[model samples]
Target: MTSPYAQQGFRVGFDWGPAGAAAVPGSIVAVVDVLSFTTAVTVAVDLGIDVYPYRWRDETAVAYAEQLDAVLAVGRSQEGITLSPASIRQAQGVRRLVLPSPNGSTISQQLSDSGSTVLAVSLRNTSAAADWVAARLTADPSLTVVAIAAGERWTDGSLRPAVEDLWGAGAFVAGLADRGVGPLSPEARAAAAAYREVAGELPEVLHECAGGRELAAYGFAGDVVVAAEVDISGLVPVLQGSRLSESSKPSRFCPVT
Candidate 1:
């Protein structure tokens, strides 16, 4: 029997974190973490860098980066090329980077073994990611897609359901709907509706949201601005094996209006 939690009847689904990802398995899975992870990925991919998602920023991450000949991103306060999108944007001479996060990156690494074609989605690249998924769906009628919002963790180490990720996932969901790729699950529809409600005021809302405010307090306000540049990116970062690189498929979809 198909698990009801899998949202089996829908062509598109939405859920939160690693558990949600496990519940709603799809041929294509998009992991969204708007405050940082996915946003940083978009920026890095935009600069022609390959991003390898890691679960922790410890010595293990250093060894993994060495194994792949990549630079390991440090904490925001510690040095060069942190997880902040602005840091990735300003970085140069980096062909590959290992970025670790407890939320998005961890979930991404967990899903790497699920046999799903994983894509990194953020406000900056929703259109491109959606278009890529939609094109694949058109080619394969059996294909299903799931958008996972990698919400932050609470102090006690529980999901905090970050609003920024909701919007980011919703933006990708809405993009798929706009491209006529629907029959969406209720969770997916709700996310799309939420995105539509705040489409016009994304920058302001992101700046004011808890995650955004926290980053701003840490002096990373510019990262929030970069993350809020909805539809500005044309590159789709697709996971191949353990690293995410630009999709080789040529995009034929219309730009977001």
Candidate 2:
């Protein structure tokens, strides 16, 4: 019995939230959190810092950082650098950064043991990420890819499908299709359409989305800009164990066997 997902040529898929992520059957998972988490990771990795993804800002995170001898990042209001990409871009003397976030980090941690090749992505490296994933799929045609948008949490703790993340994921979906990697599922197709709809107005669209507006109101609008910059980096952050580090080689797929 062939699965409908594969029947639809869904070697690629896109959906939002942890629940949506859990439903993804792809062997390669890319988590997108444009508002911050993954965005900060992109910046930090570009600066040659390794990022440890933790699900929360609790004692475990502090202990984890201590064990790794890395600095634990705080919230935006704290003294040191937080999840804000702008702050991370300006930070110095940090070899490794332990970043905790409710969405991206949680997804990263949850998928760590799922045996899938997990990848971290944001708009900052959307095109590069697409290329990286394409290489993997090219090497192993049996593997599928899923781009999961780690949407924000609403006031009632429900998942809010963020437009920025949708755009980010869509960009990857579109880029993959452009590269002729393989056929895309309806879900992936819709994300690509959504991305094409707003590709020309990314910065302004980021400024206007609900998540973007919230960050702007909190005086972190520049972070949104950082997230809106597409293809500014060629680095791809890959998850090995529980940490995200720069891909040793971005042009080829290094499968975990």
Candidate 3:
């Protein structure tokens, strides 16, 4: 019997964080963390850099980077490459980067062993990512795609649903729906509706959302601007093994709904 919590009998699904990702295992999971993590990955992959998502920025992450011969992204306040999409965009000479974040990256790493084909999705690449997933669904109609919004953590380490991530995941969901890719689960439909409601004012909405305001307060408002570049990217960063690289072919432009 299918678990009631799992959005079974649906081609597309939407959920939040690691627990949400685990609920719908073996689906094609798109991890959406638009504020920075996945957005940074999109920018890095667009620049031809391979991204390894690590769960935390610690000694373990440092060792993991060394094992992969990749540079580890530092905290925003620290020097060197950070989670800011702008930082990754301006970075020089680094080909492989281990990006660690509490929300997106942690959920991604948690899903690494769950048999889901993971794609790093953000506002910048939602259309392309949705197109890629749609093509795969065409090839295998049995496949399920779940968009997981990697929300932020509260001061006590609980989930804090971030609207920016909702918009990012919703954008992907909306694109899939536009491509005739559903039978969307109600959660997915809600996400799509959220995106459509704010589609016309995305830039302003993102800039003023809780996540955006937090980043702006930290002087990383430019990163929010980059993340708000909706559908501007054609690169789809698909995870293979532990690293995320561009899909085999460049994605064709597909206008989002």
lDDT of 3 by residue, 1-257 (tens): 88888988899999998889888754699999998899999999999888888888889888888877789999999888999898887899998898999889888878877788999999999999989999999899889999999999999998999999999999999999999998999999999999999999979999989989999998999999999898899999987777888988343322111
Best by TM-score: 1
lDDT of 2 by residue, 182-257 (tens): 6787888899999999999878988998898999899999998898888898999998766788888332222221
Candidate 1, which segments miss by more than 4 Å at Cα? Answer: 249-257
Clashes of 2: 0
- lDDT for every model? 0.92, 0.86, 0.89
TM-score of each: 0.95, 0.93, 0.95
Candidate no. 2 TM-score = 0.93
Model 3 misplaced regions, further than 4 Å: 249-257
Which 10-residue span in candidate 3 carries the lowest summed lDDT? 248-257
Better of 1 and 3 by lDDT: 1
